[model samples]
Target chain A: MANEKRVISVIVMNESSVLARITSMFAARGYNIESLTVAPIPDSDMSHITIATNGSSKVMEQITKQLHKLIPVYKVIEHEEMVEKEMVLAKFPIAENLADISVLASAYNGGVVNVGKEMIIVMAADEPKRVKHFIEAAQRYNPCEIIRGGVVAIER
Target chain B: MQMSGAQMVCEAIIAEGVKTVFGYPGGAIMHVYDEIYKQDGFEHILNRHEQAAVHAADGYARATGEVGVAMVTSGPGFTNAVTGLATAYMDSIPLVVISGQVPLSLIGTDGFQEIDAVGISRPCTKHNFLVRSIEELPRILKEAFYLARTGRPGPVLVDIPKDITVETGEFKYPESVNIPSYKPTYKGNKKQIVKAVEAIKNAKKPLLYIGGGAVLSDAYKLIREMAEKTKIPVVETLMARGVMGHDHPQLLGMLGMHGNYASNMAMSETDLIISLGARFDDRVTGKLSEFAKYADIIHVDIDPANIAKLVDVQYPIVGDVKQVLEEMLPLLEGVDPDRYQAWREILKRYDELHPQSYIDSDEVIKPQWAIERLGELVGEDAIITSDVGQHQMWAAQHYPFDRPRQWINSGGLGTMGFGFPAAIGAKKAHPEKTVINITGDGSILMNMQELVTAAEYDIPVINVILNNHFLGMVRQWQTFFYEKRYSETDLTFQPNWKALAEACGGIGYDVTTKEEFDAALKDAIKQNKVCFMNVSVNRFENVLPMVPAGGALFNMMLPSPELADSALEDKKGTK
Candidate 1:
């Protein structure tokens, strides 16, 4: 079976080593996470962890079962139908064409997040797939550095 | 009322009706051990090793159908228990492991005996916790037991900082816990139950495939009732060994790899497979595509993920097996007496054609013969536990367990040293029952130190070692697949087990002949103190009627030399 990308978000108690446990479990299985993100759920003693990995359906089932078995994990949601997004910030010399970078950011439903004397930081928030495309398209502008926040998803 | 976290730990476990705990004390857990010492209700067994402590707890849980509890110190003490935790987890045995952690200030600072207990155990345990505060200690401890014993029943670990154990807090043991997301489905869906009944009614050649879940849910009687009511021949998995009577007329022996020919063949040809409390493990479902290819699988389990997880299950009923069977029995109301008479005749023919048999030797005792003899001597009521490998398979095949929990072994993890400590725990749970650890030369060496503990505690359990001088199971695999490339499977340097037992203040016997074995076993049972009987068996004799891994269940390798050779030649593409 060919490996396919899968995103799973786990709701877990905000406690020590929970993240280490989750990540090590994936590592033990030799399943690499393409992207990962963790943030405490507002007004709750829990956190939401989103992990993106590639595996076959069978492998995915095993991973899901393994995740569900973790002690702190309360819920594991597979992003079958969900709103997924990623944010990428691209930096360019202030001398670079500002109009082109602005158009590129706007195309990805984003805009300039910060500006400095020597460089311009443009941020784009969009679906993870489009975010990858945006980074590729912005490469023509001779970007200095690119910072990416990992993929996050919520059920639609 | 205000209570120290250590006192709360005692209260919480006492509230759960825990009468015994298996553990080893160390610096990190000194405070909790102090409280345990002060506590009057709990009977604590100090194991020589942390691994055995967990296995003992697992044994206690399996025997009593209650949550088994084990405690250990941080770092290596906790790490040693990973195998035991994983063993219980895979088999869905209820166990709660209480691990001592460094104080909060010392955590993650490379403090003495510091380790990420929760992280290390997360994969193996069903759930784990790090108590951050004393107030949460009681609730977390309570939850640990609750989660360990509820739902599909598995191992849970709670890592407590030493400071928390010494710290004081208001103690309030919650009458109940309501985890919003953790409620397990108990009642099977009525519509699904009805659909299963309809499928059963339509199946001419139906097979009842029971797993450990039936035993865990105490549904053995219900399973037997259902099987008898429907006249469906039953096939049990390794964990489900004692769930059905060994000699039940309608029962085909265990199924899948190393399963009986009649059972495996019946499974392959059956039109429907009613799987209760058993996952379709790869070992049970050899060559998945060819396993029960003709059958519509009706899977009934407490865990929803288990259903249709491996193979396609047609009718998935998610609930406790005992409760589901209760609902299902009325639906089956009555079945035709002659419905599967022809199917039964076919199974009977297969049983007669390929009966489980082995050649007897006067010089060297056969492992199978020793097990059969032990079975005869122990009667049907003895609670038997086994270490993993050839010995375990022999025990399952040779011994006829007529009740649930009568046969306990490390099924999923295939742990080697599990039998000795587990047998000890079983004896502690049922002091009147005859507890025996049927082990092997290779496996007995893994946790033989527990013999000292057994002697110290006066646990009068029998340790029957089938001395084969080699890792029998691995050697068998090598013999077949690797053309006898023995590698390091030989265990000629094994300790003189009889001498070792005697040195540990227990009686010991070394038997080389069948007659010696019978006499030694009888003598050991009569003495009623911890006894080790090392019986030398044929070193080259292999567990037979084997199903080569990834081969279809119906494609079993028989015991007869000629048949085994043909099967090997066929697998090698030389037939």
Candidate 2:
């Protein structure tokens, strides 16, 4: 089978070593995790984890099955229809094209979030594919630092 | 009732009906040991090493079908137990190991005798926990046992800090546990079971491929019934030995890397493979792309992940092996008993044409003859454990095992030093039953210190050393594949086995001929002490019927090239 992009959502019990358990499983099996996000569910002891990766469907099936085998993991879903987003923060020199960077951020459902004497920081949250496009477009502004948050997803 | 955390640990073990625990105490776990010192509900056997302690527990679990328990202290103690944990984990043995940790306050401060045990054991264990507070200790303990024995069982570790054992709290052991995320499917899907039954009914040459899961689930009776009623030939993996009696008319012997000619040929040519509890490990399914190419597989296992983890399945049933077989047995009532008669006859011919045999010499002992003689002398009920090597393979191929749990060894992990310690564990579990450890010189030396532990505990398990004075398995490989570059496989400088056994307060005999070995074995079995019989065998003997690594099962390197060539010719003629 050909390698294809996949996003998986895992619901697990919130515990001290649960994240380590999940990530260590990936590392031990040599399964590549492109991006991963974990946070506790509101008003509950469970946590939701989102992971993105590219692999053959066969490997993806194995990964999903292995995730379910962990004690803390409650549910694993390989999303067919879901809302996925990634956030990125970029710092560009104040003397550079700030207007162009701001416009680009606005196109990606983001805008300038911080302004400093020497640099301006812009934030963007959009679909993972669009986030990639926005990062590429903003590179022309000579961003000093770029921080990309892991992708988080929810079923539509 | 209020009590110290140490008391709670003891209370939990007592409530769980644990009769014995294997452990080695140290600074962090001294509190629990003190509590144990005061209690009389369960006996604690102190092992000389933490690794042996865990292996003993594993052996106890495998022999008795109960969750074995072990305890160790922090840092080096926990690290030493890792290999044992991995060995049990690989075989899916149910175990609960309690390790002492530095107090919670000093957890991340790099406290003395502290290491990241939970982190180290994560990959190896089925699940693990680091106890943080006194309040959650009882629940975690309850869950650890529950997880260890239920579903597809495996070893679970609970790392309790020193402070938790010192702190006092109201201890109420939960009568039961409810873990929503950890629920295992016990009943296979009805639709899939029906599909499997239909496949069995249609297949002209069906094979019942059994593995360790069948033994774990105690499903041998149901499997035998299904096979007899359907008249399908059965073949077992190494771990599944004794599921079908060695003398069963439909048995095709073991199927794998060193599997017999008939079993391997059956696997290659079968039209349908009804795999029960056996995973398609690399050793079993060599050259995966070519494995069972003509067969449609029906896999039934308790673990869903193991269903299609390797070979794709046409019918996948996820549930307990016994329960699934119970459901599958009645559906097999309509199967024609004579449907696979031709296939069975063909396989039986293969078995006869190239039976596992060795040239018996009165001058020197053949390892195969030694195992066969031991099997006969020990009777049908003796529990045999083996270390990994040519001896292990010889034992598996030659021993006449008639029941499940009769044969125990480290199959998945292939740990070398597992035999003696495991034999101690098994003997402890069943004091009246005879237990023996068949080990090679190199494998026995890995954990030979456990001889003292066995003597200390007064568990008299006979140890038979196939002393070739060389790493026989690797040397055989070098001879075949590496052009006889011996490397570090030779171990010419060896200690006298008799002196070492006597030093450990056990009896020992050095035998070179078959008659001497027979007499020593008889004397050893008669005595009430641990005995080591070091039998010197032909140094150049090789385990025959080997399928070279990454080769097809049908293509085997047999005892002689002429035999292998004829087998190849027969396969071609059949096609």
Q: What is the TM-score of chain B alone in each candidate?
A: 0.97, 0.97
Error of 1 at A124 (Å): 1.6
Write model 2 residue lDDT over B1-575, tens digit each, in one string. Answer: 89999999999999999999999999999999999999999999988899999999999999999999999999999999999999999999999999999998899999999999999999999999999999999999999999999999999999999999999999999988999898999999998899999998899889999999999999999989888887899999999999999999888899999999999999999999999999999889889988998999999999999989999999999999999988888888888989888988998899999887766667778898999998888858699999999999999999999999989899999999999999999999989889999999999998898889888879999999999888989987887788768889998889989999999999999999888988998898789789889999877778878998999888888886433223233456588
Position B92, candidate 1: lDDT: 96
Worst 10 residues of 2 chain B by lDDT: B561-570
Quality of model 1 by C-alpha lDDT: 0.89
Question: For model 2, which pairs clash?
Answer: none
The residue-level lDDT of candidate 1 at B556 comes to 85
* Model 1: DockQ vs. true structure: 0.41
Model 2 TM-score (2 dp):
0.97
Q: Write the residue-wise lDDT of candidate 2 on A40-90 in tens digits.
A: 999998999999988998999999999999999999999989998999999
